[model samples]
Target chain A: MDNQTKIHIKNLNLHIGKQQILKDINVQIPKNKITVILGPSGCGKTTLLKSLNRLTDIYPDIKVEGSIEIDGQDILKVKKRDVTDIRKKMGLLSQRPYPLPMSIYKNITYGLKISGRRRKRFLNKRVEHYLKQASLWDEVKDRLKDPASALSIGQQQRLCLARGLAVDPEIILADEPTSALDPVSSQAIEEKFVELKERYTIVMVTHVLRQARRIADHVVFMYLGEVVEQGSAEEVFGNPKEERTKAYLRGAFN
Target chain B: MKRFFKINRKIRNTFHKRWMLLSLIVVIAMPIVLGVGLYLKSAMLLEQTSLIKLLFSKEWKPMQGLFGLWPFIVSSLWVTILALLIAGPICLLAAIYMTQYTKKYFLRMMHPVIDILAGIPSVVYGVWGVIFVVPLVSNHLAPFFNTQSSGYSILTGAIVLAVMIIPFILNILIEVFRNIPDQLTEASLSLGATHWETVKHVLVRKAFPGIVSAFGLGISRAFGETIAVLMVVGNVTQIPKGIFQPGYPLPALIANNYGEMLSIPLYDSALMLSALVLFVVVLLFNFASRMAIIKLERHT
Candidate 1:
């Protein structure tokens, strides 16, 4: 595997029920590095993330024309099996934690069970490893069998992170993981993101500029479904190349 | 000057106390009134029949001092359960389609379709069943069920009841499914789960209490339905050994026999006893519905 162009998104266009949403987007995601997609609400950052895994394909009446490639294999043109295989290499954590109506242990392991392959020893080790990685091992280890919903919102979000990590995906897509959390909780999640960049390429969509600035290794600024600019986090924040990025950072249009 | 503060303080103090007292009275009074009403009504129903003696005699003729209700009770329950068997899957499929797979236009059209089916009179349904559904079943469903009779049996009655009450179950179940958050569905689908899998694991799992309540309500609705059932079910007072067997439900018996009974205490007592059973069944149904709704509320 050439260590370049881990994920390539080219000429991406999206429409929801005949209204054009995202247009003419092109981006390259580098391997083993965080690429935070920063934008205002309804600016299509989340939509771009969802397209990588073809998650939007599930929505009926959704029109999409895009070339998203992973490791030089165009995922959209490839067979659904190949696409699902690619999806396994990419994990997603939504804005809010969605713990299944099951035990915490099972919630973390649901994806595996649904795929119809289970390994007890591996699952146990993976569960503990990911939980510890998400910094939720101590708070929930004693009550692994308890309902995941019993945990507080912050803990649930962390638990979801642990769940996503359990799949051992190299690329993690987090859609505003801390948006619904308290300040302290948000800080904790941000800290986790900073530490996670060593092992995983994390693409986080955050409306909060401070959060993006704090943890983003590379930043991709998007507005109205187009990437305005993308570069090293320091460069993007300190000297934004595009006017839209400047306007967004300065709290003008969302 | 202090009067204002004192009055405000009194209001604050009494808000919780008064609220609790009001709710408590309302809650406690309803059951009390219900219990007294049931007690009076049941006593009145039981007075006509020698309910105590009838239990031991095992004979089912009120004219001959034998007032057994075992067959009627059995038939009533048997019809309801049979009707549920016939209708449950149809309503469940309808619910799944309505909730998961349906588009906005289809959903918009659903109300009218359900409304038309629901608004059709029981007698009209009876007529329809006799004219349309019965022949269709006799030609179609009966072949599969394989009954000796060409038409008019427990199977026919249950199918009629099923057709009549399916919309009711669907309406209730749709509300239950609707109450479940769309976020749950989105969350599951985003995880690469299929439509049925999402429905089974997320949608149905989330809406279990509501579905159960629908079934209970459906059972209650089917239990008391008289006209349609009486029209189709061959009203013989047999054990209803099978769906194809001719049998009489409690309601049908009441509707048919209520007219013939005159100036006879036994006749009236039998009627009252059946009414008492119906009342108890209804009360239990309501209690079950309340419990399910409470459970659903907690689930949300």
Candidate 2:
């Protein structure tokens, strides 16, 4: 119920058929800060991130119980017709970059065009603005008309980030966004996130502890579908309260 | 014992390599052999008449030795194109719905149904056309459009041909839609685009080349279909001016006349030329489609 909480999860549980993926979870994600969900593989980090924007609805046999509130609205209860509006409030970055099968300029304009933005002059300006925001404007400004698939993997990931940002979302959810990139590209994304946290509520999921330590303002450590600890970066990383968290930070089992 | 076994294994390996090499050579030579044989058999007609005249003229008297093939060529083109026009949209939409909208279990259930449809004999399809499609066209569709015609017409042949090729085209399209990675769909959806929008902008765009090749293969299959089409398409030698009119296609011409061709002087040669034409047209179509797919792949 705190005013600073951008997203509040209450008793949320998810099941795929008979297998439970996420246990009853309660957490408060603050506004204008980087909240990193840190966990090892198969620990439901990506699943928790996906549930924020209702991306899990695409999967069959997925039963979600309880509420996921964003801006005081329970997104889980929104009707099918209104889900797109709910999704429009969040930008998501996946593990791999999947550029639209289109030219680079069109990829950025796709989100704008679908939202009924038809003015060519407006679209052209926004494309450049978002590319600049992602720090990729100079590298790709000349070849905007080329197909997006022609770009290298790092450039393509940047293009995807630019495309997501063009939607003008209030929150950014990234699921291991740098796992597929080289170290240089990974650092670029990490730096961009640190800068972007000033304006947007960023929720990132990553198994890389080094990444979690670099930019996370709020850290939520999870294990076996349960949140083991949640607090400020200093409290969770510097002053360990839970034994599991202590063991995990000390180069224990992944 | 170990030395003897090693020597035996070396001999077996050589035999295996030579056997594979011979099989590869035979596979490579099959098409070449077919092309050469068809050319030689059709050489007599080509030597007697100019290629342009034989292809462009429409005369068809056996006693007078006139064998123009323009009408048959036109009929074949009409039937194949009409069949594609009928089946193309239906198959594409069906494939998208099956892969994108339906559940996995539903798609799994449809696999065997499509296979059975494809496996049914062509003669069985011909009989079905004679019984069902012919009446539907002449008694219902033609009358509704204020036209008069016999049950057997090009329209009937196209209807039958479209049904026959549906399973083939649908199978390829299903695979094309399914092969597109889920990541693209997720990216589009995450941008606040609806499911329909994501499918239109991303999935269809990515699958464009595969869809083109699928339809191209369908066109080739419909072009050479003999039994079902031959039964429904009225064997008139004149060019068909409308879908309701009877016409003769190249495959039907060869099938219907090969029995009596030996008695006529140049009839046998003309029939062989008809077969040759079918072979070359299908070959050209397949080659063109492969080129289109490659160009699309490079662009994307």
Candidate 3:
């Protein structure tokens, strides 16, 4: 959304077991804009997105060496007690929508309630607000109390987005959020991401070149665990600097 | 060679189908036949004596022709409830820890240990209860609670039952927890929930129906447990006054009295009725649990 840098990933090397998944990556994610990490499958794109919020810490064999600073605080070096606070500043939409096994109302309120929001009026208003932001309020307004799984896949994805937004995160991390969706559903999510870019910093992972071209404001093209090129969307998509990036854009191979 | 191989494959398929059908018939027919036989025998006893008198009368004198089952019923309920109360929380917590928190090395070590625990015979558990649990409760747990017990009491049986059922219920719970997708936990964690919070809100909520069914199965096992319970409960055919007092559960009563049933007039029928009651109770619980699991599967 602006020229100001919000997240700075420096010399981030990630390895699972003996396999190196991310090799000395460095990138600056701008604030309040959609930064799409474009790469082939299994090329450490999801791994990179996961490390930004310290989600990779859950894996026992994972070793991460580097610092990821958000808003001048090195999240990688922060105390374990502060991880929750750090995570609270960002939301994530996974490849598949996993709505908490509860009513749609409770799914949105679960994060709020755990973060210590407990007023009925406030929860109601916030639920409506988030649902509207995801463009799901009208479709699900009458059945807010229904099980979230009862909705269609597209609706569930939007509901997942609403649930993520209800936490009031400053940034959104989506890992191939629309790959599981149909064309119409993918379009809906793309449009929502465009609308959400005005308020939240979004970093998306996508293997689809056209999707990257359509929704990316800033582009970071990664190949085989390395960032080949990164710049404004126009420059990277239209005039890629690296041969690997050009070959990938030309659909030589994924 | 190719025709010979095809003939071998066809033979294997036919053999497999035949075995599957045979097992299904054996499994279904045995329970139905036994249940009907037991029901008819109990029906004869019901006709000889009023159902109310058989159910409500506290006097269970076989010599004087009384067949009341109130005390045994009460004992069964009390012992099962105590066993479940003791085992349920410990088993659930152990299951959650094993699935959610245990390291891979520990988990590998634990799987065989749990399997061995599950495979140990009920008769072996009975012997162990007599030797170890009885003394522990009478000498330690009873004294700790400032009560006098002679080692064979409802509390002792309950403790033994609890130990026996933990691995049983825990096996089911671990499987249920494992079936939950990793994405659900990731979603919760990304929303700023701690590991424990994610477990409490997401994992537990997702697996609740399965957990409930596991408990139901555990309860049914406790209800029908005869050998271990008979060893520790001090079978006294009377309502227990306290956790330290002896009690007579239905299975124990039947197991103890079946040898002398032919000597008494309607005693065999009474014992069979008790068996019928146990069967029906366990059946009801299994059915409810099946329904709950199905509903959960359909929902998710």
- Tell me the DockQ of each model, to 2 decimals: 0.35, 0.77, 0.64
Rank by DockQ (best first):
2, 3, 1
Q: Could you say which candidate leads in TM-score? A: 2
Model 2 ranges with Cα > 4 A deviation:
B1-4
Pairs in steric clash, model 1: none
- C-alpha DockQ for predicted model 1: 0.35
Question: Which docking band does candidate 1 fall into?
Answer: acceptable
- Candidate 2 vs 3: which has more DockQ: 2
Per-residue C-alpha lDDT of model 2 across residues A69-187, encoded as one tens digit per residue: 99899999999888999888899899999899999999999999999998999999999999999888999999999999999899998999999999999999999999999999999
TM-score of each: 0.87, 0.97, 0.93
- Cα error, residue B198 of model 2, in Å, equals 1.2
Write the residue-wise lDDT of candidate 3 on A88-123 in tens digits.
889999998999999999999988998999999999
TM-score of chain A of each: 0.94, 0.98, 0.97
Better of 2 and 3 by lDDT: 2
DockQ of 3: 0.64
> How many Å off is the CA of B288 in candidate 3?
1.4
- lDDT per residue as tens, model 2, B1-300: 999999999999999999999999999999889888888988998999998999999898878999899999999999999999999999999999998887788999999999999999999999999999999988999999899879799999999999999999999999999999877888899899999999888899999999999999999999999999999999999999999999899999989989875888888888888888999999999999999999998888
Q: Write the per-residue lDDT of candidate 1 for residues A1-254, one digit (tens) a residue.
A: 36755888899899988788898888888877888998889989888888887876556656789788788878888675545566667778788887777678987777666676598987888788888999999999999998888899999989888877766677888899898999998889888888888888888888888888778878899888788999888899999888888888898976
List model 3 lDDT by residue over B156-180, tens digit each.
8898898899889988888888888
- Model number with the top lDDT: 2
Candidate 1 error regions (>4 Å): A79-83, B1-58, B137-146, B189-192, B293-300
Model 1 reaches an interface RMSD of: 2.8
